[model samples]
Target: MATHFHKKPNLYPAHVQLKVSDLARSIEYYTTIIGFKVLQRTGSEAYLTADGQTILVSLIEIQNAQPLQRGFAGLYHLALLLPSRKDLGNIVQHFVNLNIRLGAADHDVSEALYLNDPDGNGIEIYIDRDESEWTWFDDGQVNMVTEQLNFQPILTAADGNWTGLPAETVMGHVHLSVANLDKSEQFYTNVLDYNVVTRYGTQALFVSTGKYHHHFGLNTWNSNNGQAPEENMVGLKSVTIVLKDEHYAEEVKQSLNANGFIVENFAEAPAYGGAQLFSTVDPNGLRILFTLDGE
Candidate 1:
């Protein structure tokens, strides 16, 4: 007789949600500075979209919400994908025009521009290079380092030329800060089964699936041993997940507990990065997640 055992599954976010205090202010900032399209809005609640994906970025009124706090578990950063460097360049121009406190960097495999959304949530707008252009380590970990981004050429040539380029894009990645790096890594890898691509000392862990670089990242840059964020401060609200199966979600939950993780999810959680997910917090008080894909 042969012994057999099941496998622990991986998770990807379904859709990450955010609760902003001021809908009108959020709408203008997202649509104008960040380039997110306004899908719809009602009173103090509003919904926004990036590249036609469906879900609501509910901007709840803070009047009745809890008081905001800094360094709490909430939205860290939502990565917006661009088709090409040219598109990234165009968007950078828009930000430059408005002086949106942008942070620019070239991560060998991708060019990124960082900023905060209206609600003070971190936002990253970026475009990736081809696989052939990626520099990998012996262990398949990409040699991702910040390089200086020269936005002169792309901006010099055009204005509002990003949408003209055609390429499939989605929310490419999300990076966060947690209270404990090891605990968070365990939840994301052992529990979520997200492959670790690299790390930055004891402070960070980078994980990913397939071959698209890191889709999830956690670090203790700040907020180590942090408490749960107050409802008031603008930060991560909820992360969406699509799963492959209920069994998969359940399997993942078992793994997290087995690995000594503290995970929280609604109903039955399934495995599948695009399908199922578990919205959680790490040691640094960051909003972390694992989601599966759709069936």
Candidate 2:
């Protein structure tokens, strides 16, 4: 197990380097279609920042790497982390002004707004509540539930409009779609050691670390006994997980392997605090990477 290869200076975290099929098409869809702004770009890659979180959809124009398969364990959703509930409130106001209706839910630990990207990747914009406020069961399990999220306060002029968020926000969590909820929860929470935030019978489950709400979510929405995706469909390119320190990152990479998650390679991602990213293929064969936070 290795660690991040770059320097991390802040708490702002995100999953960077999403490999895509067509760089131009993805860039167009993110910028024009999904309303993301282009932060930077090189020969074949483009970095886009949305609501203050900087993410790079790196278009590796190579004849290698595992091809994407739909119907399999693709991205369940990409959560755009907000600074606070006030930050989320402003975003709600933005949607209100645009006459866009969004799905709101309180997962006991977080307040979230659910929507979709241009390519059908589920997107969740959210803010975490105080850790002390997170409930726990008598058996020591974290308790989470879907509740009503109040948006009226945010829509008021007094709260402020959340149009262009600053760069302090992040990608707090990455949710996934699996064939079975229990099985997925076992892999993430039990195997990976994330505390169980909660579960919804057989439909879905949520997990997190240090009771900071949910760092991961799993659901059996469209894929009960799910099938892997095809090579042509555009879905979750890859998910980057940021860790705290080089030692911690190194620890996680080894833990993943000991837990039976087959690791492909250990690469030097100096862009991510010099963290060593160990990519793994799940039962559904989705590529998930672990890296470090960005500045």
Candidate 3:
């Protein structure tokens, strides 16, 4: 995997928080199917880790939580980037052995498998091709296309051992179902300083920092002019973006303020090692937390 895309000097999604109806059931699915170990678990919350040190995904159980509502502005999927093609092959074989159905796609830039949790929250497991193979235009847009993934080569690359998620796995990107394409693009680009990397016509667009394929995919495919999901719904709770340092976080906060966006500050948790942290909502009402990388 490319370390620079996820590490400091480029803002990337570090973690994701999801709302589920049942903590126990969700934990089982994440641990068994997704190959994540429980990092910490409280009464109604569980933090999952693949490397045992960094938290990648968190689940919070809400009382009387409703099922994920379609046509709402929320998570389309939270992507987990694997370290290598062989790792991806192993997981594919594992899924095949377990008879778990998946949606596979080759986006020219990466090969991805899609599935949903027990709560219907989407999850994407993918492995990216080398940056050398990527195609970029002079217009600053990266070329990406959804094509049928040939599974034979990936299966051939597999060692047929399915232990669990590799330690190198990281939260790759987030795809969101938003209400308006233009507003979402403006907010992510102007406020968050992301550059548009690719566009799927008027229905969707991809944006990123440091010219990675995409860090976030904003789409209005099913949610055009739709409203945000209710708070108690089984869907995305928030997404965490890891900034390089406190200074960059402060600059983002200032940008949000200058744009008349409401910035909410929450107390720093010990888990973050006292890194500066704050949150703001996007134009689609998706909450985004910004924090400095504790490392």
Checking candidate 3 for backbone clashes, the offending pairs are none
Better-scoring candidate (lDDT), 1 or 3: 3
Compare candidates 1 and 2 on TM-score and give the better one.
1
Position 92, candidate 3: lDDT: 97
Question: Which digits, one per residue and each the tens of the lDDT, describe model 2 over residues 100-181?
Answer: 6578898767778888654456777777777668787876667777789776754552276444653555667778888767
Local error of candidate 3 at residue 21 (angstroms) = 0.5
86-168 in candidate 1: lDDT tens per residue? 67777777767777788888888777888876556787877777767887788878788888987786576445765421234
Best by lDDT: 3
Give candidate 3 regions above 4 Å deviation.
270-276
The lowest-lDDT stretch of 10 consecutive residues in candidate 2 is 1-10
Q: Which ten residues in a row have the lowest lDDT in candidate 1?
A: 1-10
What lDDT score is found at residue 140 in candidate 3?
95
Put down candidate 3 lDDT per residue, 73-162, tens digits, no spaces: 999999999999999999999998889999999998899999999988999999999999999999999989889999999998999887
TM-score of 1: 0.79
